[model samples]
Target: MPALAVFTATAATGTMRPTIATAVAIVLAATSGIAVLWSTRVGAGVGPDRAALGVLAVACAMGAVASGVQAARIHTLAAHPLTELTGGRTGVQLLVTGFDRPIRSGGVMVPVRVEVTGSGTSARAAQLDVVLLARDGWRGLPPGTRVETSVAVLEPRSAGDPPALRALTAPRVTGLPGWTGRAPAAVRERLRQVSGRALKGEAVGLLPSFVLGDEGRIASETREEFRAAGLSHLAAVSGANTTYVVGAVLLAAAAVRVGRRGRIVVAGLALAGFVAVVGPEPAVLRAAGTGAIGLAALGAHRTGRPLAALAAVVLLIALLDPTTATGAGFVLSVSATAALVLVARPVAQRIRRPWMPGPVADALAVCIVAHVATLPVLVASGLGSGPWALPANIAVAPAVPLVTVLGTSAAALGPVWESGAVVLAAACSPALWWLDTVAGVVAGLPGSPAVTPG
Candidate 1:
């Protein structure tokens, strides 16, 4: 709950109590790692599948424990360095860590890593301060870049007012980030550009959002239509999208006769890259952690229950970012994913008719479980939904993988070959067309009664 900025990678900026937690987590991690090794032993009388699952469970525990250690390492500043500077001007070098805060003048609230350049030398570079940077181009400074400027430190005028460090003069970019920053931004921009050129109207906006979870370009009306159609989760990157993207990459890696260790490497790298491309939101981070676990199991030549992975990933994310433990996005995502894992297959078998295809029934079941699981969360916020949501989701469900896989492919190819990316992106047209059309039709349908959470 301290001043925090979550990053897309395995990092965060926050104040926290450490020591005991870190030591305990390290002990737990070591024990879990040993369990993973022991699970691999033969003659345990357990079936191969069960043994694999045990190994996976242990591995997930180990990963979560490691995350706990890292989280505890985000040290709390001993004193409020800026308390006396309220209502005063001071010099400082700041890094725009992320878009945690949006300013009214198109600038953003950046987490400033304070390196004292003023007479006040008590501030440490290790400490981060949330401050307003209302200068031109300040918002665009990606993670790891530095901003140097004089700033007026202002106290919170109200409970909602986060302490602001208003730039007293034009802020200058004193540092630029290397590939750690540029590569992801470039890839995302390339995808955006190709999407603009290759797709028309709403698809241009929706494609990037669907593939990369960047819904910045989606119009308010389009978003509303999707919401009405019970497809709003599709607008942002959800856990399933992350899993599917990772799964597809795993399939591709396997196609070329990649060994188990090699396939793990391939999938691991792909999962990391996908996370980077998507921008590490809470849901994506949860999914990424889960995906990473699956990939790790693959490397070990073992498999784990998806449900176990989901639970462990949830725990891992909570350990890393405690603030997100009660977040709506986290709750909704976990609910929807848990539903799919627990009931999708069983529901698929029950619902399949003599004429219905297995995959189709399975997909339908997935849609059903997801819709059912997330509906309460959706309506709890007063975004009233109805029965219309289910059929609308069913209509658009088939296109989801097509849109995700091909759309990701196009985005990956965008930076290297714009023309090739466009060609690959053309495959997503039918899917995109159907999505927009379904949202429109469902939004217009009569008798969408609002369902309130009791």
Candidate 2:
């Protein structure tokens, strides 16, 4: 991820305006394109090994130049149009840059984070990121929608939130999400409705969040319990979610007698659909990439190197949006996945005994290694977990998959099979009850509060 590091640093420190940045990017691209062509032609004349090495070197150089140009685009916040407003309030138009996370509701007013397209009609669309405290009207709107309003720029309210920009007045919807966004939005809403109708109390709130990442309805108390228990990641759409969905899709495809190549295509489409339904959080994005690699491995009937896949995911994401690297969730997701890929199996193998079976050893390794993998990050960020966190996660681990699969199946059956959906959702009551019991028990334990720095 050296390229990622370079790109992020450059973007964070870039000072060029949009015009200059764009011009530079075009120049870099043209130069790289020419060099790449020249390398291909000249290298063909040399021995095979030398030719391959030459091509690889040219590719790396091109990547570095492209990274610099992208950094220039990311650092657009430093331009005069945005810098001038950083000191005070101003009216501007903003575009929703991502649809990954849901808009957070703080009572009547919601905090909707949208990227800055421009501060005014005359301002260029450099796309500086900011969060807006907007009205109820902003809720349920899909990403890619545009709103115009006045805003007061201020320091970020919290680590997870970006720089706060309070709306002086309610934002007016100037544009709607395109047709491509409508289906995902609709699917999410339908699933939420299905969950509400099929489940009760804790299950109602937990199911959608667990299956779809829609945590809006979760009670504050329940959230605290999950947090203290370190089971919050269960609601973050982990790889387990994708595994269940993809696994089911593959099974169905197989039953229908689809060939290997066709199954891959079907699984890819299904994975995309699942991401849309869950919405795009950093965690969800990570899960999707990992799931894709898992599917590829399955297709080849070979145990591909997972560590390499993880690195590829990191690199691809850096190219797509290096800004994702800044999120705490991203760090935790990548680190934990890497730990599982690299450390979990060995630990499990060492711990395994005749009395302790493979499944138990694997589960123990996952719970322990996940916490260890994320420990440094959490500590450095002044985040912590209770003494009960690890035990609680381990205790609740088995129940998670049960809740996930049933919850997912219920949501999938919602529109077409309402009664069946309700029945399946009702089936989750036992697991939900167990999860709640474990979380409450763990949270109430002495020394369960996350440790804070001295």
What C-alpha lDDT do the candidate models reach, one value each?
0.65, 0.66
Candidate 1 TM-score over all chains jointly: 0.66
C-alpha TM-scores of all predictions = 0.66, 0.75
For residues 1-454, write the lDDT of model 1, one tens digit per residue. Answer: 0111111112221232355445545655676676666666745576555566565556546544544644444434223455446788877777665433343234445555565535445543444446565655554455667767878888764322235687877768888876666766677788888988888989988898788766656676776677767777786666667666777777787898888789768777877777777655445667676445433332332333665676666655655555454356776776776676666667888999999997688668878887888888777856547569889998988899889988888877888889999987878988999999998788778865432211
| Model 1 global lDDT (CA atoms, 0 to 1) | 0.65
Which is the leading candidate under TM-score? 2
Off by over 4 Å in 2: 1-75, 97-124, 156-162, 248-266, 280-283, 294-304, 350-364, 450-454
* Lowest summed lDDT window (length 10), candidate 1: 1-10
Off by over 4 Å in 1: 1-94, 98-139, 148-171, 250-266, 279-283, 291-304, 379-387, 444-454
Q: To one decimal, what is the Cα RMSD in angstroms of model 2 from the true structure? A: 6.1
Report the C-alpha lDDT of model 2 over 36-144, residue by residue, as the tens digit: 6656566445644555545555554545554564545545444435455664777777765444333324433333444453554555554456556655455666666
Q: How close to the true structure is residue 121 of candidate 2, measured as C-alpha lDDT?
A: 58
